[model samples]
Target: MVYVEVFGEDRVEKIKICGDFFLYPEDRVEYLERALIGLPFTISEEDLCAKVEEVLGDCVLIGATKSDLARVIKKAMVRA
Candidate 1:
């Protein structure tokens, strides 16, 4: 799940991401969360997916794909 706090009109102030998924070099998860901060809350799924892919770099993720993660973030943003 993604837990986010927004700032201004559409920026992400803080965020927490967690679920059953596993990310190797496990610290990459924290890095991903950090990277997502200060981003626009209304960001597109494809753009978010690309950001995730970039932040994840060589790290390996199991149980979730980039698009899946992007969709989850988009859903959470809408809910927020």
Candidate 2:
């Protein structure tokens, strides 16, 4: 599972991503986290998925996909 914290009103000021999933080239997750930092809180699942895919590139993920990651982000938004 992933836990995310998003801060801002009209725009995303910051984002924190934490999870127990496995991602190859582990630093890639940091890239993903950074990519999401300044995005709008209202960003759609598809857009987030695209960003994840773009950042991930050819990296291998164990037990997760871009969609799954996007879904987790969406859920975090809902809870926020």
Candidate 3:
């Protein structure tokens, strides 16, 4: 599961990501979170996925994919 909170109207003023997912080179998760901080709340899943992949680079994700993370972020936006 993942939790995301996004703020602001046009751009994401802040974002918080939390989840029960496995990521290789766990330290890179911070990079992922930071990468998402200023994105537009209207960002598409595919675009977000691409950004996540860019941030993850060569890291192997054990139990999640960039798509999965993007989906969760979209869901959170709906809830927000």
Candidate 4:
């Protein structure tokens, strides 16, 4: 799951990613979370997924796909 706090229309104040998912280069998970900080709330799922992919370059993620990450992120943005 993903949790995010948005302070303005297009800014993400903070975020957290946690679940049973596995991301190679395990330490990169924190990097990904940090990358999600300040993400635009208005970003589209596709774009968000692309961003995630960019942040996770060369890493392999199992038990989830970019789409899943996008969905959880989008949900966090909307419900934050």
Query: Model 3 segments beyond 4 Å from truth?
Result: none
Please give the lDDT score at residue 68 for candidate 1: 81
- Candidate 1 stretches with Cα past 4 Å from truth are 1-9
RMSD of 3: 1.7
Put down candidate 4 lDDT per residue, 1-80, tens digits, no spaces: 43444344667776777788888988987887788878778888889989888988888888887678778888878887
Runs in model 2 deviating more than 4 A are none
What TM-score fits each model? 0.83, 0.82, 0.81, 0.82
Q: What's the distance in Å from true for residue 80, model 2?
A: 2.5
Better of 1 and 2 by TM-score: 1
- In candidate 3, where is summed lDDT lowest over 10 consecutive residues? 6-15
Positional deviation of residue 79's Cα in model 3 after best superposition, in angstroms: 2.8
State in Å the error of residue 7, model 4: 7.3
**TM value for model 1:** 0.83
Better of 1 and 3 by lDDT: 3
Residue 5 local lDDT, model 3: 77
Per-candidate clashes come to 0, 0, 0, 0
Model 2: lowest-lDDT 10 consecutive positions:
6-15
lDDT of 1 by residue, 1-80 (tens): 33333334567766667777777988887787778887787788889999988998888878887778777876666666
* Tens digits of per-residue lDDT for model 2, 1-80: 76777666645566677778788899988787777777776888888888888999999987777788888877666666
Q: By TM-score, how accurate is candidate 2?
A: 0.82
Distance (Å) between predicted and true CA of 25, model 2? 0.5
Which candidate gets the maximum TM-score versus the true structure? 1
